[model samples]
Target: MRKIIMLLCLLLFLTAAYSYPQSIQAYTAPLTADEQHVLEQSLSIHEIDREIARIESQQNETERSISELSEQLEGKNEQIKDIREQAGARLRAYYMGEREDLLAALLSVGSLRDFISVLDYYELIMDRDRTVLNNYKTEYADLKKTKTKLESVSAELTQIKTNLQLQRNRVAALQEQVDTTLGHSTDPEKLMAMIEELTKYWENIGLYEVRRYFRALSTAMSDFSDFLDDHKDSLVSEKGGYRLEVREEDINAFLRDKNERLQDVSFEFGQDKIIVHGSREGLRLEVEGHYTVENEPENSITFHVDRLFINGFELPDTTRKELEEDFDLGFYPKKIVPFVEATEVDIAQGTLTVKLKLSF
Candidate 1:
């Protein structure tokens, strides 16, 4: 059977990331000016910051989209007008059963050096209205749809900006409240108690679940190392080292069986790095990173997180480094099989290869 006991433990723990619980009786108070009589402590600064960043990114993207769509929509109308004008002025008499007038007008329109030159479908049809208007109808519909999309995205951008402003005001209010509370209180003990309550809010918001998620990832890595050790005796050896290649499909199957924790995330193998992206708890999460050989010539290789994002909020370098070091998803093969050390790790296309060598 697959080793999922510890992995499941991680999964079960991480699912509670949004709501941090404690044995202490929870604070009871009104949440905000809008939410009256709700029994809860104030929202954490970290949560508000994340929300603002996510909304701001969305607003920027929407503005760019609206600009591009407006330009396209503007040019589309002119294109349709030109194509129709060229078709009517040059080819209208052809379907009118007047060959002489058709030939004269077609020849007179500067050798039909207009939309006819652009479209170049003159020889393909006698029904100019049907052929040229075919393109017109499609272009017109696309132009209309572009208008609709532009309007929608513009509205969305407005709402995103509004939300961002509201979040900013909340942060300001929070700061003002904290400052006022600290200014009035002369007792050091009461101030420390108030600071501790805020700390609790920060710890409970989402940090606990994030750590649990990392542990689950670590457990999966350890299990893979154990698998390689158990099968080392029967594995093929080349160039004095053993190589194991696990494909993306293989990893997905293994993870699904090993731990159901990261159900929302999917992993892709790049030339040298692993790409992870998915929607988690209504936020888009993206991670790009790779593993490198142990720096101290040890038995393990460590995962170095290059980039991480939630919605569009990037994790700070300091916090990212802390997470990477604290929950390093490393494989220590020597601990499992004596003298065997992981020498190299690389990701290519759909596969992740680990090369192990016996050093002693």
Candidate 2:
């Protein structure tokens, strides 16, 4: 009977424990977002305080240095003032018209140093007073710059102080809530979630480095395009009348050496179509040509009709590297490989015309 009572009591206790409600706690804290933001602001405030303190200490050292420099500058100024009033005054008087007395005074200085000093005083008096004035101007500019910098630093420090106070107040408010509720959270999950949010924000915004690079590239391209547009006509006209300019030397060289100056000219367009006209007819090698910019920023321009119907046809051989170089269409990519549907070149009545239509 005793064993049965003990077993029944243990079973009842187990059943009651099993019936107890389970408490499901959150893995992360439920702190309001505003509190988290306040925490982040507090951290920034701490960093700002450290930076401001460092800067202020540096500023104090700079101020002390400036003070010492000012004192030294003041003494130098007084010395300069005395030199002007005494030695400089006498020198000016001498320059006015007292030549003989000035000469006598310079001679009366017995030692070499004294004589040199008298001469220096005469030279620096009123004639080169600009030197002293410039020195004063430079010092004033330097002091003004230093003061401006200090004012900026002081303003920054004030802002840092204000931010720090605001952060402290926020932290105090959070502490009050904690105390009133008698609750504390040291949840790692909550901290990690907040950190992840901040990280995402930073990543999305990116940085200034790539933006600066693209900005520079855009500026350079704009300047380049402007330059090209400005000089487009000059580049087009550079080859105009180039043939005549180098023709004279070729004729002269041909007269001197026969085989050394032999050259040939051929014109074709589109298909592998060939057109031939004998020199026996009235066809002149000298031709006038007009070119139209079929494809802007050209490609290959082809002259379709190779044969010309002229008053006469004259075949003269001329060997001139300069002429070849001048007319080399390979020099311009647009003229060579036109981004167009087709290019046509025709020669008629000693006149050559090139028409181009570019698609690309």
Top lDDT: which candidate number?
Answer: 1
lDDT by residue (tens digit), candidate 2, 278-301 = 121111233222323234454433
Model 1 has an lDDT value of 0.63
**lDDT (Cα, tens digit) per residue for candidate 1, span 1-360:** 255888887776665443333311133222233221111113334456666776788888888898898899889878889876866754655667665654555566654456465234444444655767677678778888988898888888888888788878877776666655556556535444634553453455335555666777777877875554444543457787677676787666655566787676577998999977655443355778888888476657788888765433355443456578778676776665676777778889987787888778
Q: What C-alpha lDDT do the candidate models reach, one value each?
A: 0.63, 0.39
Runs with alpha carbons beyond 4 Å of true place in candidate 1: 1-206, 229-235, 295-297
Per-residue error for 189 in candidate 2, Å, reads 13
Would you estimate the TM-scores of all the predictions?
0.42, 0.27
Q: Which one is best on TM-score? A: 1
TM-score of 2: 0.27
**Could you give me the TM-score of model 1 versus the true structure?**
0.42
- Clash pairs (backbone) in predicted model 1: none
